[model samples]
Target: MTRIDLHAHAFSAHTAPKVIATLLTLAHRACPGFAPHGDGTLPDLLRAEAAAGFDRVAVCNIATRPEHHAYMARFLTALRSGAMGEEAARRVIPCVSLHPHDPDAAAHLKTLVALGARMVKLHPYSQNIPLDDPATIRLLALIRDAGLPVLCHTGHDVTAGEDDFAGPRRVVNVLDRVPGLRLICAHCAAWRHPETLDLLLGRPVGVDLAFQPATGVEPIIQRFALEHPLEHLYFGSDWPWASPAEHAARIASWGLPQDRQDALFGANAARLLALP
Candidate 1:
């Protein structure tokens, strides 16, 4: 069977290495207990993807600083154009972003897309912006006009302080304003699991099983696949946060009936994205 790891992340070494290294150092200094894992480098992620038999992995890089936009844009252009080191680049599809609340947010998004951003990554928690903030409405309009999907970070981000709600319910407010925009709720919509399922049962939005119980939630994910239109659901590992091997194993051990497993693992994403 064809394998498509729809949600995994890897950074281009050519961009932001020094900044990322500095951040890693600062993280250790600020939180002595925080031991970072191997940086999700291109080579490491590609190896993991290959081992998991993933033919394509969509990498969504969210912005953390103003300067990051251009660097990330360039990196994404390389991925979309198949310019990121031949072998590693082939499996990665790059998602783009601008701080949704940025002052020139709309223009930035347009520039990113023109530079080759296939989708946008929005993080309410880390970005410190309410999902329904007026700026997001404009941002959503820009996305809709561009005909790109928005992969929203709709859950607790372990590193960012828990001041915001990453719940799917909050996103409904934003969705209400831009009903036609394509949205992919990352991490199974976090604490809003069934509500997330409910949202998708009636409407088409993408939900990724990035951190769901490697064991417990398998049945729920499978149930959703069997009960809902297959195109509305997608499987993503949130790699670097979760391993490809672990994600593959989790789906395998779920022991779902063959068709359901096929949908969750690959078919659904291919159909949703209109991939081959």
Candidate 2:
């Protein structure tokens, strides 16, 4: 089966070196003993994913501040224009980010679609915005009208403060408000908050098994597999934070039926992205 990783990240060459260094440092501090499997560059990410047997990886880029919008837009433009080598471009699918505080957030979403972005990634904790804020709701409406899928970083963040920006409760509110929105709640809606799974079940939403370790999450995953439709669950490595190979191996060891495993690894993502 063709394996598609629905969530991953790699720094663009245009990303400031200082910013990259800061992010890497913060990541290490947030998760003690956390070691990245690849350097924070596109080429390195591609190599790591290839080594892990991933056929395609969606690289999620976030803009914490408003200024980052144009820069990321330009980067996506160049990437889609083949400024990056064809092989690298083919393997990496670009997912744009929009800060809820950005005044031109809607415009940037349109720009991403024009540049052939299949989806967008939202990190409310990192971006410091509430998922149910009016501005965010407006943005979701725009995405819905554009017919694009959005992958939201739901649950708590180690680096964040007291605010529950992307918690499952807020996400559920968003879903209730924005009917027909194609949404993917990352990290199984915060594995710690298993109640999120109950809220998400039977909804027209997607959930990715990213950052979930088999040792602790296996039972939860098994329960989800049995209760929820397998078609909405995607396999994601959450690379740099987790190992793609390790996650794939864990999924393989789940002993799920071959077709269910196939759906989790790739087919579900393909259908969501409308990939041929």
Candidate 3:
């Protein structure tokens, strides 16, 4: 099977200004902004993913505000244009997000789905909304009907806690409502292991260890693999946020079985996404 990096990012110069501005604003409210302290552009993230042996990766453009839809759309257009004039752009599979509460978001989402968006990325923390909130519930419904997978950030507190959409419980509600909606719970539901464990075991949700640092959550990840095997878990670099070398090293140091390692690195995501 081909190596597939389920998670990745490609920054578009066309949308950088808006993203930077939003991050600056978020940095004021949310502890960590969209970009890391010193993270570079999409190209920088692409280099890291490539060096880590990822064959292809997904590009997620978030929509936090109603006005952000245009910027997100432009970025996706540039990424999938095959006209970005860069090699990295070709490797990207675009995933666009929409603010569930945005009045016109539903219609815009329909348009994007028709154009070939395979996934929907939602950040309750950045948007300061809960995943189980009415608006989000409706949004999930729309995305589900479109046949797109939803990748939601669950766990930890960059700024807000459970109230801001980092709660796995909220994810559970949405999942319960939309039982058929495919979801990738990012970060192994970091800091919410009990809930994350429950959801994964109870349902067929997939977990990705994207930001597990060498000293961060390696032990727990190793334990989870031992407990559940790799078919239910996926490896993600969460590029621009964590170094690919760091993620690769963790896997190397753990020395998991070859089959399990292969599943974690790519096969699991392919299975979840029903990829080629």
Candidate 4:
């Protein structure tokens, strides 16, 4: 069976060390006691994937601020065009991003598609835009028409502390507003609120099993796999912050049939992204 990790974040080695350090600082602040396992580089991430038995990963690229859009676009171009290197190009399915506040956000989405991005990544907390923001809705509609799914960071991001931007209600509300938007709620639908799973039933939205909190919500994960559309259930490890292997192991322990476990760990995401 194919294996693809639908969510992982790593920086190009060409990235400046200072930027990596600053991002790491904020990430560490999110969980002060837990130290990440890998250095914030593509090579480090690739090694981790190998150790975890994943075939490839959809590396989520982000532009945290409006001003960072152009810079991230360049990196996205590099990764997709194999400018990052043959290894990265072959192993990565680049999930592109744009800041909601950017004046050319629509055009940015076009460029990302033109650059061959397979999926999109959005963060309400990090990008400082609510899911219901007019600009965000507009962009999401465009993404839907483009036939691309977006991995939306839902609920809270401890690093940024904006709790209301992507709470479970807002995430569901955006679905009503956008109609058929393919929004994949990150952090296991909504962190610390596994009950939100009841709200998500029957919706076509996607959800990833990731982060440390995910392991604690064993009942939610098990029920989600058993009841929901398995194709929308992705295996995410939020790598560096947590181990991809740990997430995979948790899924393996669920006593699901081999094919079901295969879909949860990798095949479903492969179908969604159409990644090689």
Best candidate (score: TM-score): 2
Model 4, residue 149: what's the lDDT? 93
lDDT of 3 at 193: 50
**Each model's Cα RMSD:** 4.1, 2.5, 3.6, 2.4
CA lDDT for candidate 3: 0.68
lDDT of 2 by residue, 32-73 (tens): 555566666778778878888999989888778877878777
Candidate 4: global Cα-lDDT? 0.76
| Candidate 1 lDDT over residue span 231-262, tens digit each | 66677887765678777787667565777678
Judged by lDDT relative to the true structure, which candidate is superior, 1 or 4?
4
> For model 3, how does the per-residue alpha-carbon lDDT over 147-266 read when each residue is reduced to its tens digit?
888888777644343453666777778778887887777776655355566665435676677753522555555565556645767776666556666666776577678787788777
In model 2, residue pairs whose N, Cα or C atoms come closer than 3 Å (at least 3 residues apart or on different chains), thus clashing, are none
Q: How many steric overlaps does candidate 2 have? A: 0
Q: In order, what lDDT does every prediction score?
A: 0.67, 0.77, 0.68, 0.76
Model 4 lDDT-worst window of ten: 211-220
TM-score of each: 0.80, 0.90, 0.82, 0.89
TM match of model 2 to true structure: 0.90
Judge candidate 3 at residue 14 and give its lDDT. 73
